[model samples]
Target: MSNRAAYETVLPYVREWVSYKVWQLRVPGVQVAVGYEGEVLFDEAWGYADVEAGRRLTTTDLFRIASHSKTFTATALLQLAERGALRLDDTVGTYVPALVDGGSPIADATLRELMEMGAGVLRDGHDGDHWSLLRPFPDEQELLALVLDRGQKVPAGSAFNYSNLGYALLGLVIAAVSGKPYNEYVRESITEPLGLRNTGPDWEPARADEFVVGYTGFHAARHRRRIDHVDTRAMAAATGFHGTASDLVRYFSQHVIGQGTLLTDHSKRLAQRKAWSATDDPAGRGYGAGFIVDRIGDREVRGHSGGFPGHITQSVFDPESGLVVSVLTSAASGPASLIATAIVRLLDAAADADAPGTPIPDGVDPATFTGRFANPWGVTDVARIGARLVEVDPSAPDPLDTPTRLEVVDADTLRMTAGNRFGSIDEDVTYDRAADGTVRSIRGGGGMTSEPWSVPEEAPETAAGLR
Candidate 1:
């Protein structure tokens, strides 16, 4: 709308921005897509696909979508519901008897409930080592075993804890009800029909050139550990699929324009409804089937966020203005919710032909701000990391900070990366200057902001305290 450049320009910095975010947060890579009215407005690929190889991400980069995969699974289920084959309220036990055997039938779980993440469940195990009986790398049946054996972590219809195992079972229920494998259903119904190329449920390392190689986040795990070696087979419907942002724009476009030929109007609206509400922060909002529905400032957003070992994917399309945005990172960046919040703010202004003003990067001279400023949210240890460049602590031990590279996100505020889901540093490192043009203090990352410390003349110089 009004030359894509007006909107697209803000997105490409993804490479540079994510690079800083990765350095600030110690993440690996990021891929992002921003759009409106079902059309891609902007898309960016930043950081590395394989950091060791020094590979950079492209709009075509691919990474594990993780729980974002729930959107597809829930969509398929809702499609069936729209067809009168299933009901969001139908109990899982009614269809898949084995789901309830001795304990309770995971099948008895309502499709709506599963989509809303209402199923009380425990994590499969955070260590990422336990394999559910549900399925294995090549075999898919182990998924079912996982639900049956593990049962629900909590009573169904309880709190908002997330369960990857829950969506997996929903996939099986789709099979039992539709009589088709989950992959076949997604491809034939979702991908093929949507014409989303370069998108699928797994990876082919040998076919590396076709898609982006996933990046890892374990600082110590590197060299001896592999984070991208995720179990694509067992992670179906939760964190198994991989695709490009360009394709995702097309996919999200369906929800905006009603994909009149594919997804029905009712189904699209159904997908946008709220199901679960996060209680982590008091400001948390509610969840829909697969999407987390909420408001930012005042704008309402419909979408979901995902995080696996090494990838983060966030996608959302506004229902009214047809605005949409999707960011796929190759590292564990921050919560996608924050991004949705950012988009809502930007788009609200964009819809009115306005743009947020750019903030100045830390403008204070290094000398006025160079000191061992102590803070927990972030520590400011100003040290010269390179000639002619004074590196600030936790902000520049980075493999990515450039001289003018700082991101002045707001008029007077500076931010490095986002929170660490995409491996971004979630800090508020803004600066304050004194009337004398000297720096005052710095704030953010959950601590106070300040200028460089001034030593008293009465104090002994150099290691005086130590002596």
Candidate 2:
């Protein structure tokens, strides 16, 4: 099936799953957006932006987006490189002489190393109390002091030592080379040219009220406390971006080759190419210029994850299908990656149903057999994706991992045609209908009964020390 067709089949399930997960896990709020073939196919939000104030979250609400700023920083550098402003192999010390003057080992690190996190600079300097709001983020003078005091802890390029300080130096390099402030250059060259109205490099006092109130996790605490938004100061290039989910997916979509004119096709390819392994597993994960090279289902995706004080976010793009998914949340401990991965997995299932080898059973509308059912064991979702029906365990971390394909057995009976060893293959699933032609209950293998399940009308009550 075409990418658009697959998205149509999977979008309904995506919405229901996101809504259920947010409520089940007691997340403060979540905003999700999907981009397909240069267009946004699905955009939705759930839960409250401000829990205590009872403010419902909306698609337009801005999120901190923290580490996602690295992608923007990387893109800005690549743009400058294309214009013959600087070279990737140039040592950062060539632009920022403070490192050389301080005799820091990081002075020898190249721009490429810093962008890909290969530089041995300290992750967040000696003290990272700013992350917990105990101290203010370092300014230019303090950042220089931090670098001179304890920035380089290991030899450059010895290993993948993820460092926010490394990117901060790159920010300084951008300013030194372009003769314009890092944030101003990024806005004029990236966001403005791409028409990204909701995106910015850092917190804006003028738009303070436009941002959603972020909340702490309910770990070891009776209730989640609100986290005050603060600027990342000199580290804004590394961890201080704010935007709506819609604009984020749209911005990343430009990275997909030939999708947008923001960056040259050559630059996009270089940004998406795997430069170094991010993990020990040979084929597990890797890193590009600023993108996280990983897999969602069977498709390789390039994107990034962001974690601010009380906001967690994840964005991934499937280059093969040109499908991009972004999940933004208000709680610091939210399952942003989990929700984003599930969306891609569902799309993979829908695309599999269209494969020539897997023939979808005909003469029985899969929709009639699709609905959420509850038994004493747990909840089961019979989702209809592109004319195929699969039983999904809603609570699984990856819902489509071991799907049970249901086939028509009779008017009211279905048979499990395919599944893993854990599933009961060829088992009959009979359902009873009410007078109005609505399903009342279902009887599966071993004669276990399940009734229709619905999400709660309101958010679940929070228990002490637990959501």
Candidate 3:
């Protein structure tokens, strides 16, 4: 199916699912935007932006996108590289001499290592109490002193250790090379060029009222206490960014294939290529230049996730499908990442539903099809619903997602019925059987193969009622 058709099928369900999640998680406010092809296909806001004021959240409200600023920083650096101003292999000391002369390991690390989080720089300084809001975020003097005093925690080119300090140093590099303030250069070079009005380096005092009120104490109760927003001065390139979900989706569009106008093909590839694996598994997540790289089924997605004191956000771009989703939440503890991921899964399911294989005759007993299947993505439960068999992701946050009725098409194949409440298109499930006819593996519509889940005799009942 075309992306537009897939988007139309998935959007309604995504909206309902997101609304259900906001209520289920007791999230104070959330904004979501989805981009398909070259334009936004879905934009929505739910819950209260200010719970005490009884103010409703709007999609235009600014959110502290936190570490998402890394992408901007990475983009700027890549632009500078394309101009022959610097090279990714250049050491930090090449731009900032104070760090090198002060015997800091970060100074010796290459810029590429810093962007990919392989520099092994300290995540935060020794006086990292700033994260607890005890003190103001570091200024240039303090930022430099922190790096010089604390130095690096691990050897350069070591294992993947995410370091905000590394990005902050890149911020310094941008200033030194471009002869412009980090934020000013980014605005002129990146945000402004892309026509993003709502995105910026940090909070603006003039726009304070338009910003979503962030909250703390989320873990203790649904109603969290308000948290004060602080200006991340020197760290703006690392953790200080503000924008709406729609703007974020639009910004990320620059990373999509054939949609990018901000960077050249070489630079885009440099930014998106996996530089270091975040997980040990080959198929697990990795860090590209400034983006998190991972796979949902067989498709690859590149983007960044951000977290600040009172806000959390996630953005993902599926280059193959040209689908971008951004989720922003007011509470730091909110399930922004989960909600974003669930949306992507739904989009994938919708696309898969458009093509259902031909059906064969039914011969196998329906009871034999009832079992839990396990895969890298998650668990899929196949259970007998009355006399009908269905498949469902019971762990999904939204309870309204209707199960796909499974019809036996052949001895080992089942065809998913069309027109489900979840809006997922029809697909097929094929089972691998052992010599004695015991199910070995179950392959779902999206090419996800799952092994039969071994269960204990005293385990909970695994039938349709579980949903």
Which candidate tops lDDT? Answer: 2
Weakest 10 consecutive residues, lDDT, candidate 3? 458-467
- List TM-scores for all candidates, in order: 0.67, 0.94, 0.79
Q: Which ten residues in a row have the lowest lDDT in candidate 1?
A: 458-467
Q: Residue 117 of model 3: what lDDT?
A: 93
RMSD of 1: 11.5
- Best-fitting candidate, scored by TM-score: 2
Model 3 Cα shift for residue 69 (angstroms): 0.4
Which residue pairs in model 2 clash with each other? none
Order of models, best TM-score first: 2, 3, 1
Q: Rate the local accuracy (lDDT) of all candidates.
A: 0.58, 0.84, 0.80
Task: Judging by TM-score, tell me the better candidate of 2 and 3.
Answer: 2
lDDT of 2 by residue, 282-378 (tens): 6888888888899865799999999999899999997656789999998878899999998887877777744322334666666677888988898
Candidate 1 Cα outliers beyond 4 Å, as residue runs: 1-27, 105-107, 125-141, 204-206, 218-226, 257-260, 280-283, 333-344, 347-467
Count of backbone clashes for each model?
44, 0, 1
Error of 3 at 300 (Å): 1.4
Per-residue error for 313 in candidate 3, Å, reads 0.4
Assess candidate 2 and give its lDDT.
0.84
CA error at residue 414 for candidate 2, angstroms: 1.6
lDDT of 3 by residue, 1-467 (tens): 46577567556656756765675456678999999876888999987676666678899998999999999999999999999999999999999998978888788899999999998888987888888899999999889998887658889997889988789999999999999999999999999988899999987999888888887744665446778788999999999999999998888887887787888867888899898888778678999999999876567899999999989999999865578999999886778888888788767655664333222235656656777787888667665433345576645763226567677877788878853634434677898999998999988857678997642222111110011
